[model samples]
Target: MSDPFIPFESISYTKRFLADCYERQSFANAKTVSYHTSYSFIYHLQQGRLYLQQAAQAPIEIKPMLLFYGIVQMLKACVLTVDPFYPENSTVLAHGVTARKRKKQGYRFLDDEIKVQKNGLFLHFLDKMFHVKQMPDEKYKMNFLLKQVADMHPLYSTMHNQDISIAVTQKSQSYMISDTILDDLHMTANRFSLFLEQSPNSKSWFHRQKGITALKQQITVPLHAAPTRYQSAPWLSTCDGDIYMLRKREDYCSLPELSIHYLLLYNLSMICRYEAEWWGELHHTFEGNDLPFIKQFLTSTTKKLPLLFEHYLFSINER
Candidate 1:
């Protein structure tokens, strides 16, 4: 219950932001299906944005609010899964249901990808994730995404689809599903911003109740695709297959209290490493350092750590 936003000095500005990261929900609330859907989506979206920056070789910026939105989307996807924690990964972990499934299946793909059985339920789940429901006008385009563009345009044309530009060698390599997802996400985020501007309901709730919109704003975006770093062997399939830990009461109690700080600290480390890697890449491309700009932006931005714990105090951890 201590502040998760205490900053570290050794890492880059992005890493600093990561080190200080806090979730709007506690591990207890985060383990539920509802939180999983909303939270994970937002996480996935931010990861998607990060992937885009990597592809473009652009300077990394920390937009915690935007990332929070992405985590929500990932949560939604996780809730939809048959087994929230144990979907098949490219590499077998020494833990739960997925490892058992891999052993039974017996066949592996060329790149050690799981030869996932054509389960209708699984495919249905994936379809929903890829297919966009809300259209601009409910017509014109079917929530256009990367799969659509890759199918239509040439490799070069596809590169220009995303706002960020990246140097890729192969046609397939250049086309990232994350880019397309971000386009849709940006539209929704812009719409949400407009909604806030127009309606006072945003402060309370559409129905006269206390809504968690303020808490939701903490994460910037959900993940569109898994991190590109996991695209290689061992982690490839798992990377593609969304791995979400839902907001369930059992899971919440299950997480050892001692591990909570360590778990969070580990993620903080990841954020730092990822940020440093991105910064190095940006330096390689752009020449002069922009760490100061990143630091200033992060320092100025408000964090939702207190709000996250406040929201969860009554709902999940009540005695």
Candidate 2:
């Protein structure tokens, strides 16, 4: 056999190029599935967060639409987790369609799909799972967070339509996005990331590995019922849906003895508190010009969110 010439600049370059090519091929061959279980939902939610973080920290000029797109993906994952069989929104076509045509036209808008089904089974599911009646009307509630995300559509469209050359500017040899817009984007991305991770439904191999401990008795603090002043700073929720207030002074003594479930709940509750603070700032500090959009977004988004999020957001804001 005759010796063959290689095309890459170097051996390392050839290896890296081939690896990337194989990765792309593998991704293309992969089939998309509904995230009906805890595992799939967490996976997609984390992927969305990863992309948002990457977009936020990118040094070069990058469209924030990437972040918004990731948020939409997270939203889809969330809705699917609630109702795996939720019908896809179809703008056209009737029930009688050829298989090939159905496959070709199966594409659906995430926003539209969510909106149509929001008030039905999903809402009922939320109410039952999260105790929606106990959640407050206003605040950085889960519903509010989701609404903020949904309201980004108009902003996304505005950014998406802008001329790239005009939207970005070079300053001191570095490209920069508008300070106001960038700040909002960063805040929104961070909020969504926190919400998804702290969400009660959030579960993963990592969390499982930590080992959960089922308590002997229900704590019965009713963390989600009505907000009441507690002497302790952190509270833990048992698997049976009871809350126990953990005193700050006892941390040193109790920290080492607590189970993974308590530790996780405590950490998640803290994140929820942080989210509330951020929501307060965002609500009060936003410019007058943006208030109308924010208000409208909140109204529409809240209507579409699951009831569980509404309660979760309210429960965390209690402290």
Candidate 3:
């Protein structure tokens, strides 16, 4: 099952929270810009919410376009929290990623790819949120993005007979990762332990639970410190009463899950807006695996993206 939608409180009441965020982050001239920044924040957030709400009533043909705008607005709001004066210039306003539309035979959305642009919301978002510098000029495939989500765990398992995750169970202060993950990641316990240590947001180095075999033959290891037990790479999600550490394609390990969501919505929105005939045919024919993957991805996005950003927005309030 996918993550349940747990969007943050309504946008109407978040101006104060946002202003405070500006001040808390100690952005230059926080006092001078917080008012205007908070206003923009509310506008972006409201627009995001409105678009997603509209997408809920939209048909499949139009859903991606609406959802992409919604997702972009949400991201803009998040960026404002950090940048204070976002869009410092017009160049940052572009989609930041471009999709290639080839008329070659057997064109499938699953095999479709999007290339990351050097500057734009995608790059700025990555820099501000994750502090990633110098991404390669590489095209990321849709299938690669799909495999990163926990929601797709069941879908891929059922359809292709391929498992994408290692079951993770959390008990109080620690998470037990399925040792079966060893074969999936092709790493020994020590190597895997080292891998997790190098992940983003590594506050404390985690180690294996000593001298005991966890139930169901899992390896018990605590991922973070108390009260804010965040997951690192090979993501650990506390949602839905279990943790799913998804094993994704190469170069995906370091990316934030939200980035993948953004890329998916970006490409789909491009298809919906620019590739009319192809999109129309796909919707009418219900052909192949693309439809189901896109269907499930949208379902997962509308429900989870806002919640993920909500968690992010509020979490930084502590800083």
Candidate that scores best on lDDT: 3
Model 3 TM-score relative to the real fold: 0.87
Query: 1 or 3: which has the higher lDDT?
Result: 3
lDDT of 1 by residue, 1-319 (tens): 3522222112243222222221232223333443334334334434534432232332234343333233232223232332333235532221111111221232211112111233322232323322212211111111121111111122224334533222111122111222232243343544534432333212221221322122322312222222222111111111123222111111111211111211222222233445455435443654332333223222321122222222222222111
Model 1 TM-score, 2 decimals = 0.19
Output the better candidate (1/2) by lDDT.
2
Clashing pairs in model 3?
none
lDDT of 2 at 163: 19
Question: Tens digits of per-residue lDDT for model 2 on 1-319?
Answer: 1211122224443334333433443433222322123344445555655654564454212312334334444444434433333334432112111111121222211111111122332233233323233221211222212122323334434634531111222233222233332243333433423432343433311132322222332111112222211111122222222333211121211111111111222222232243345334435765333334334433332222222222322232232
Worst 10 residues of 1 by lDDT: 230-239
Tens digit of per-residue lDDT, candidate 3, span 1-319: 1322223343434556666777787766665676677667777887888898898888888989898899899889889878887899998998788888654678888888889888789989888876766374768889987877777778888878877676776676677677877667777777776666666665443533442244566877774443222224566453353457765436255667778888899889888888888888888897788888899888877777666776677777774
lDDT of every predicted structure (CA atoms): 0.26, 0.29, 0.72
Which candidate gets the maximum TM-score versus the true structure? 3
The C-alpha local distance difference test score for the whole of candidate 2 amounts to 0.29
Q: TM-scores of all models?
A: 0.19, 0.23, 0.87
